[model samples]
Target: MFCLHFLVTSLPFNELKLGRRKYSERMYAERAKPLAQYTTEELYARFCFGRDNIKYIADLVRPKLQHKTKRSHVLSVEEQCLIVLRFYASGTFYQVVGDNMGVDKSTVTNVVKAVLVELASLVNEFVSFPKDDQMAHSINVQLVANADLIITNCVVKWPGSVHYAHILRESALYRKLRSNRPNGIILGDSAYPLLSWLMTRFPVANTPEQAGFNSAHCKTRCAIEHLNGVLKRRFACLNYLRVEPKVACNIILACIVLHNIATRRNVPLDDIYDGPEPDEMQPGQPPMFAPNEGQTGRVIRDAIVRHYFRLMT
Candidate 1:
């Protein structure tokens, strides 16, 4: 053993290439400088937020993301925020994102998880629903937005195969609506069962009044559709989340929080290509939970047709 150790030590460091090699220092590339140099437009294009906005986000998440590690290569709060944002904006592989940021894929994965957990914790503070995943694998995101395209409420828990109406029926909002009822009618498409507080389109608009009601309902309800479009546009990663179902759910919620922030701040969307949200359900399908359709909903629909849509048409 002594002779073997002596021989091993006698070999020059340059010639000891075959066995377990020791690195003198842990190598850490300068990760933040390149991103720091990006212009506002360039930053927006890549991170989906300008320098100022990114800084603001860094400040917001710093409390949760800031670690007390003594390691010299530890990521700063700002750098950590950028890494996750880049992942969300690009929706590319972790290795791809890490390469752009001068970090390893493992680092990218860690930072993404930490940041998503932090942001997703803020869902209640930012999002307001009128109330309150996975296989080959996808989750249905149910969103409610106002005219300004700001998402007021969102549900991001159901599996991809779950029926839309089933999702609604199972929501806290549904129970609240059932118990207290909405002050104003909420418009939903044909897939949703007609409820007293939630109006779905008529099956056959035989009369001019019913046709006009359908037209008005469609125009107004399109706000939610536009919200979905802008959301996926701003965070293209959400278009096709590559993570497992649970992690993917957190990513979706995190994106929703960021989406609201961007929308409220009026961050420009021109940098990202905008498109319509793809509709998964076929049109003209029978309404879900038809047996459970509320009688009061039919009365309200007829009243709206007689009182409002009749005058407009």
Candidate 2:
């Protein structure tokens, strides 16, 4: 009786297998309807793959939220560097970067700021003014000994502005004057009252001829402008930043660091400003001044030109 019952059940197994095959065939036929008959929206919903794939991969790699715990999110030093590099290289918005990296936008902002602070510290380490006696010695040896004079640029601002313009001016002057030679003189344009102040502190190169010379100065001072252009071009997202100004400042500094690194490695800058003619200045505008110099200023000016030439070569 047990053998007879087993045989009856086994006989239905073949029928069940056939029924499954038939069902699968029916499903395939139903799915084979002409895709062209669908509306554009329906076709896109059904067949589009690229955007979905990107989102899917991003989702798959996204970090899971942790419950309140003792452990913190741990990012390694190299990973931090990569984050900074990608920010500078691609100029993607923070939200987009966060989406791609599977993190929050705030996390991306924090990573960039941290990277800038660290890099600024490193730049200060490698490039800095020499101290008291050594600074004096270097000034005498490098500037006074070889050059006719030194020209310095200065800018005036409210007492507590965070801009580095004033600090750079002071630092450059200190570095220049530390050498006890009298031959080097500092130069400044009209905007800097501190130029006169510096002249009183030490023998500086400011003269009536040097006043209002930035238009002329553009020939040589174009490097900084070019640097800024290179920065904005490479990272187009900088133009449309939606973050707070302080965060934007940090992002800008990080880009500067990356620019220096690329420059040191001899990477050529892309010229994004190569276009048709620029707009003409309107009537009544101040005439653009060219760098004009008397005998005293010329000697120092030539020295600067030569110095930069050597650096570039």
> Weakest 10 consecutive residues, lDDT, candidate 1?
132-141
The residue ranges of model 2 lying beyond 4 angstroms of the native Cα positions read: 1-76, 126-217, 237-249, 273-313
Give model 2's TM-score versus the native structure: 0.42
Each prediction's TM-score against the native?
A: 0.83, 0.42
RMSD (Cα, Å) of model 2: 18.7
Worst 10 residues of 2 by lDDT: 140-149
Kindly report which residue pairs in candidate 1 clash with one another.
none
lDDT of each: 0.75, 0.39
Candidate 1 structure, TM-score to reference: 0.83
Best by TM-score: 1
Q: lDDT score, residue 188, model 1?
A: 76
